[model samples]
Target: MKSALSAIVLLSLAAPAAAQTPSDWRTPDPENILVVETNKGRIIVEMEPNVAPAHVERYRTLARKGFYDGLEFFRVIEGFMDQTGDPQNNGTGGSDLPDLEAEFPFRRGASVPFVEAAKLPADNAVPQATEVGFVGVVPVRSAPSMQMMISVDGKAPAWGLFCQGVMGAARSNNPNSANSQFFFMRGPYASLDGQYTAWGRVISGQDVVVAIKTGEPVAPPRDVMKSVKVLADIPAAQRPKIQVMDTRGPAFKALIDKARGADGRVDPCAIEIPAKIG
Candidate 1:
C-alpha cells in the first residue's frame, strides 16, 4: 500500500516536469526568422507577417540583398532602443528603396491564434477593454472576443504591444516615412504602440541589444550589424535550428497561471516566451 502511494506521487511530479517535451515547442519558419550578426552579438528576430505583411517583406528583401550589412547603430538610447539599418552609419541615411506606409492596428480573424494572459478593466478612456495575450511569440492587445458577432467581417482589431525586445521601424514625422532604418527596444514603451510600425520581436540575444553603446547619436565607435540575412538564406549546415515555446500548449498555460499569482493578473510585457536555438 505504501509502495503504491509513493508511485502515484512520483508520477504526479514527473508529469509537469515533462510537460514541455518536444511537442510543446513550435519551430518558426526559417524564411520568417531574421538573423542579425552585430558587433555586440547575433540577434534573432521572428517576423510576424500576419501582423505587418508589407514590413516583413521589406525586411526580408533588403536582408537577402545584403542591404543591411555593415550598418552602424547610430542612435542608441539606453533603456529605450538600439537604432540601425542605415547605409551611411548615421541617423539620417536609409536604403534607396522607397518609403513604406505605416502598418498598425492590424485586423485579425477568428483563425488567428491568440492565448489571453490577462484582462484589463474598463476605464473612462476605454469603455470596453479586453485582454492582453500572445499571438505566436509576439505580445498583443486584442478586442473582446464577442466583438466578432457585431463586426461586418468575422475579424476583430489587434495590435502588438511594445514589450522589451520588440522591433519597430524608424520613421520621420510623416506617418508613412518608414524605410530601412529600424530599432530594437531595450524596454517597453507603450507610447509607440499606435504610432510606429512594430513588425517583429527578438527571440534571442536581447542581452546584446541592451549592451550596445548608448547615446542619442552614438559617437565614432558605434556598433555595426556585420551581416543580416533571413535564416532560410543561410546554408543548411550553418543555420541554427530555432524553436519557441508554443503559447497554445498546456505548458505555457501553466506558466501564465504561475505568473499571475494570487492577484490573477499579470503585466503582458512581463510574460516571456522561451526560445531555444540549436
Candidate 2:
C-alpha cells in the first residue's frame, strides 16, 4: 500500500513536467507576420488586421513597394517608445497613402476567436474586456460577458491591449490622421488606451528595439531598419518559419498560473512569451 502511494506521488509530480510537451508550440501565420531588419537587429511584428484593417492594408502596400527600406528611426523617446516609418527622416513624413480613420474600440462578436481567461485580471482593468487571452500569439483582451451575448455576429466592441512591444500608428492632432508612421512601445502607459490605434505587437527581438538610441521624439536613432518585409511577401527560400508558444496550450496556462503579479496579482504584461524563427 505504501509503494502504491509512492507511485501516486510520482505520477502527480510527472504530470506538470509533461505538460510542456510538443503540443505547446504553434507556428505563426506567415500572412500576418512582419520582419523588420534593423542595424541593431531584427524585430518581428504580428499584424492584427481585424483590429485595423485599413492600417494593415496600408502597411502591406507600403512594404511591397520597399517604402521602408533604408528608412530612419527619426523619433525615439526613452522610457516611452521608439517612433519611425516617417519618410522625411523626422517626425513629419508618411507614405502618400491617405490617413486611416481611428480603429479604436474594435467591436467583436462570434467571428473572432476570443480565447478568454477564466476571470478578469485583478490587476489592470480596461473596462471593456472582462478577460484576456492570446489571438494569433498576440496578447488580446476579449469583450465583456455582456457583449459576448452578441457572440453570433460580433457586432459589439473589443479593442486590443497595449503591453510591452506593442505597435501602434502615430497620428497628428486628429485621431483619424494615422498614416504609415508607427511606433513601438518600450514601456506600458495605460493612458494611451483607446486613444491610439494598436494593430500589432513585437513577437521577438525586444532587445534590438531596446538597443535603439534613447531621447526625445526629435532625437536621431542610432540604428534604423535596413529593410522590412512581410514574411509571405519574401521569397519562398528567404522566408522564415516562425513559431511561438501557444497561449492556449497547457504550458501557457501553467505560465499564467505561475506568473507573479506586481501587486500580488498576475500582470499580463509581466509574461513575455518568445517567438522561435527557423
* TM-score against truth, every candidate: 0.89, 0.83
- Candidate 1 clash pair list: none
Number of the predicted model whose TM-score against the real structure is largest: 1
Q: Taking the tens digit of each residue's C-alpha lDDT, what string does model 1 give over 1-278?
A: 00010000000112245255888788899989999999889989988887788889999999999999988888887777888887776666777788898887778778878788988777663466877788777778778877888899987887877788888888877778788888888888877766777788888888888899987678888888999999998999999888877779988788678779576777667766777787
Model 2, residue 229: C-alpha shift (Å): 0.7
Q: Give candidate 2 misplaced runs (Cα > 4 Å).
A: 1-19, 121-129, 150-154, 218-221, 260-265
- After superposing candidate 1 on the true structure, give the runs of residues whose Cα lies further than 4 Å from its correct spot: 1-19, 124-127
- Please write out the lDDT profile of model 2 over residues 40-112, one tens digit for every residue: 9988887878777787888878888899988877667665678878777666677777778888877665666
Worst 10 residues of 2 by lDDT: 1-10
Displacement of the residue 63 alpha carbon in candidate 2, Å: 0.8
